[model samples]
Target: MIKIAAMGDNVVDCYLSKGTMFPGGNCLNVSVFIRRFGGVSAYIGAIGQDEAGSVIEKALHDENVDLARLRILKGATAYCVIGHRDADRVFVRADLGVSMFSPSSEDIAFLKDFAAVHIGQSSGLDDHVSAAAAQTLLSYDFSTRRDPEHRRTIAPLCFLASISGGDLSHDEALAIAAELRDCGARWVLVTRGSEGAILLGAEGLFEVAASPADLVDTLGAGDTFIARTLFGLIAGETPHALLSAAAVAAAETCRYFGAVGHGAPIKLSGVVPELQTISS
Candidate 1:
């Protein structure tokens, strides 16, 4: 079995229009998705002492994701207030809350036992990337951070790097993928939304069309792709097979309401002032 650790960032996505919230954040979603794929996964991040934190804890526990490294801090949990426009999610407000944290030496020691560690752009662990990569394969989600210099700096340190190119044209996506590969990322996956995805690796470029879905929400689809693809790589699957499977998993995620589907009624009064003021 592939065992991995997801370090950094956790948030509750609040859909104010629908008065519902879901546990999300790239690292958190990846950990949950890995477990759903039958891999052993652990989450390492901080959360607040509020209801939002409780909600996240419950969902992670229910999914059987290891929370041995989870921290319950004394502030509000990180959150993003979302609004929908023709079914696409739009962020209206956001707060980092207690989510920004660096892994300690002991945490890094524990992470070395895993097959890989997954982190994202929002995960405040950029300084620790080199150290962590030295001990285990590191999977990074660059999301929409497409600065060439930034990619050049971090790509060489990542075993597998994923980027969100959904907004870019086919040529643009291919260009960025090639750049990341040239910068030394052993494997690179570029997701282009409806245009499907492209993977660049040792064998060369491989493209796969996006799988069909009912399309309820597109929030966690990319994260699903990243998590599944990473797991398949560790399991020794071919690039074509893994990307194809990942596209299907991503489509499945689109059929749900939240990142991993544990939705709860939004309690504005219990959240931070920024969230509470929005409802009023």
Candidate 2:
């Protein structure tokens, strides 16, 4: 069976103000969503043999995501200190640790079992995996990175590119997606937190209003959206159907303090998904 891959970087998120910690990263969160939505999912990334890394590994294990390609090195694990409120957030500090992340030949060889790959924000990792997974559909989260040269490098590689508009107005969000389209994005998307999301494709722009969520920690909301979008694409769903599912999945993530179904005890309501059983 074809599995989907979410690989690149992950970090142990330290909620300094809240005195809590959790495994969090774009790719990791994407994997979390895949497993919950009943898709065969794989996570490919590097981690150290530290306590924090142990927690991350355990978390992934709990999610039932395949970790055969996970690299455990000998050093401190990547970590980030975050400060967030009921409605906002701030990154206090971060360290990438000793992880040198890039897909190995063995990892690429494993992609034959997968149908799609979601590229996270690691430049080096992207450099390696994008070309290797050439046969698979590729999607990316732009992460509010507006640097022209950087966007140029990543844009062409994406079948769909998601850009964060945070709280931008309708016109503002459209502008961001347009810029990405100009930079060669085949499908451009702008995610606007609780407001909704906007998409720019061959048929022009479409908007998906945010699904209702009792707001919790907003950390993994965007990541969940990326994962949902990937799964929808692999399912051969239309863009309108895909974005609607993505919006629901993302808002569902917001109802809890972390990404859903990574042992979150959150039940997915609304639409029923029909993917394969999650991989162990």
Candidate 3:
């Protein structure tokens, strides 16, 4: 089985509608979808001891994902308030809790068994895991970096990268991806929401048009796309086939309510005995 370790932030995504919560955050979401696609996935990060943290813990367990690396702390759990406008979501704001969760050498050693490591936009954890993931394939989601310093920092670490093209045109996005490659990324994937995804790497540059679907909450579509793309690559599918598969999977995620909802969350009681002693 393909083993992948996802290290970084985990957030409790709270919807503004009725205060409904979901387990999210780029790396956590990726791990869920990776497991859904048959990969042996593990999530490595710090989750708070609050009620929201319990929700995240229960959700991960229900998804059948490995949670041996999760660290519990006393701080408030990180969360984002998602506002909805029809089928689309608007990011209201976020309180970044546990955004600074960086694993130590022991944690990195545990991740060495995985074929690849997926890094999230969790401040310093990207750099922290890059060294540990050196022997393994490392991929990161840069989100969108308009800052030159941030772009430079992203370079020379991860083998593959994913970023959102906010308002850049086709040509502009291509240029940006090329620049990212020059910086250090072996492959640069630019996601353009409904437009589709453009993948630029050593083999060649290719574009995958978006699959049409009934839109719902766009919470974890990008995470699903990344997970599917990685799955296809691990399965030895061609680039074109992988890209197409990823696009379709991402579109399928929009058909659901929030990320991979395998079933209802299993309510967890009491503090995590093993995790309670750990500090943030």
Best by TM-score: 1
Ranking by lDDT: 1, 3, 2
Model 2 spans > 4 angstroms off: 122-124, 260-280
- Give per-residue CA lDDT, model 2, range 154-220, as digits (tens): 7777777888788678887787788778877778878888788887877778789999887777888
User: For model 1, where is the 10-residue window of minimal lDDT?
Assistant: 271-280
Candidate 3 lands at a TM-score of 0.89
RMSD of each: 1.1, 8.8, 5.4
* 1 versus 2: better TM-score goes to: 1
Displacement of the residue 13 alpha carbon in candidate 1, Å = 0.2
Count of residue pairs whose backbone atoms collide, per candidate: 0, 0, 0
Ranking by TM-score: 1, 3, 2
- Model 2: per-residue Cα lDDT at residue 229: 72
lDDT by residue (tens digit), candidate 1, 1-280: 8998999999999887778899999999999999999899999999999999999999999999999999999999999987766656677889999999878888888888899999998887888988889889999999999778889989999889999988999899889888889999999999988889999998889999999988888999999999999999999999899999999999999887889989998877876557767862
Q: Write the per-residue lDDT of candidate 3 for residues 1-280, one digit (tens) a residue.
A: 8988788877776653543567788888988998988889998888898777877888889878899988988787777666778877777766777656767787888877888888866545755755765657888888766665776777567667888775678998988888888898777888888889988888899899999989988878888888888777767788899899898888999997766653323222332222223222
